[model samples]
Target: MANQRGLATPLGVEFAPPHRADRIAALLAEQDRWSPADMPAIHTDTHLGSAAPLLDHLRALKNLSPKAAALRDRLLAWDRRMDAQSTDAAAYAAVRGAVVRRLAAHPAFAALAAPPSCPEVLLPWLALLPRIAFALEHLLLAEELYEIDRSAVVAAALEEVAVLAPAAPWGQSHRLAPWRALATTSDDEPGLAGDHDCVPCTSSVPGLTDLSARGPAARYVWDLARREDSRWVVPFGASGVPGSPHHRDQLPLWVRGDLVQVVTDFEQLTKESDV
Candidate 1:
């Protein structure tokens, strides 16, 4: 499960140690035998199950204004797939961002706004917005309100997003934005599916940006039965030689989470040198 969790990391969801170990152990124990064909399902089992409780609470909020109620209903109706084309995911993101931003600026959390005196490496933790964004679930559901009306914040956020957010697919804004060795002509990349907490997590820094700065650099499935049946894919391609046909050839496959089969048979090899 460590290996599977590692693969899932690029997608965004890093299962907590306790849950990760138990879940994977349960899955393994349930299987009589495992095959390469079963690897994909095991690896991609990331579902946004974490958000259900919070979503249910949001749906049950009392006396939401008309616009807020409408947005809430839409969210309730969402399939929670977090697919690249999901507009509901985009809407959720917008609302979440707005709420975090508002909370960060609220006087209730003023003391936390001060930058930590610790090292620069720990700066992200000291940032107020990130802190709020990461702990939003707790903030929304906390029994003891911090003198701030959480319900009002959600309603306002929903109304604000309805007017401010562009009508576009979630992937239009949430995409792979990896740091490149060389500057490209365009920043345009493929639309991604999944969320920060999902199995195929495509999470960006919440409250900061929607553009994904981190994701799976590569994907692979090793076949114990037949080594040749193993498959792999990198963000770019197999060949490192620039100007070669193989350069960037695997990109589309990578984008689609597909893999190329490994070839080990010498008979299938194309000899480039006489030995």
Candidate 2:
């Protein structure tokens, strides 16, 4: 059996780990602390454990009337009930009903049958997008939304579910996917396809995080008038040339919405790297 060492460019450098815990620990350590914080702080906050932003956004947008409020409340109530259930199935069913009612009655939900955009910051949350869809269809009468592309959404959601679903889970998906320059190529394909719903705005799944749309990358709107105003490269540059490690080396950080500058100059670089 091949060792399942995973690699990714989550930050500027290639992150290949012998185990998931190693990667998680590296991430947590880099940030220094963990736990969800309010919005402004959320950007700097090292760890975000819950899908609160998605739920809050959905509740805000869908709760247009007293009926919507009642539905939302019921959904919350069911969540609490699920915590105490001896049989998860019964709890899931009740929770599912509330989600369905809330989704079916909302006008905005009409758009779920089509593919949605992948938000920048919320890309990591992509894994959960399908589960959200499953809840929508099973709990909420998703068909009542009357989408011409209903089946399209279901198919896309199922693809995502295949990655983490209990039965015959995508060991390859988890083990070999998300390639890195240092790692071996993966045979497994990502569950998401161009035709599938990929964004919170158009996705059939409710309670999606807004990050799915904007992305987590730092985007600078630089004003050209300033003299010092300009852009720079990361890890120096490609070729791993003596002076420049590699141009556009920070691609992963950019993808993940992290934008700390890579120090290239001897005066600015860390002591160890300079030495």
Q: Top lDDT: which candidate number?
A: 1
lDDT of 2 by residue, 1-275 (tens): 01123343343342212232332344556666443221122222222112232234334443134544444444344332111112222222223333433443345554553434677644433433344543442333333444434333322322333232222221111111232354543233222110011110111223332111222223332324542333332221233333344434554443232434333367765543442
Model 2: how far residue 226 lies from native, Å: 1.4
lDDT score, candidate 1: 0.70
- Candidate 1 — worst ten consecutive residues by lDDT sum? 14-23
Candidate 1 per-residue lDDT, tens place, 203-264, comes to 57667788876666676888887898898888777675556677678877876667788888
Per-candidate total of colliding backbone pairs: 2, 22
RMSD of 1: 5.0
Q: For candidate 2, which ten residues in a row score worst on lDDT?
A: 193-202
Task: Report the CA-based lDDT of candidate 2 relative to the real structure.
Answer: 0.31
All models: lDDT?
A: 0.70, 0.31
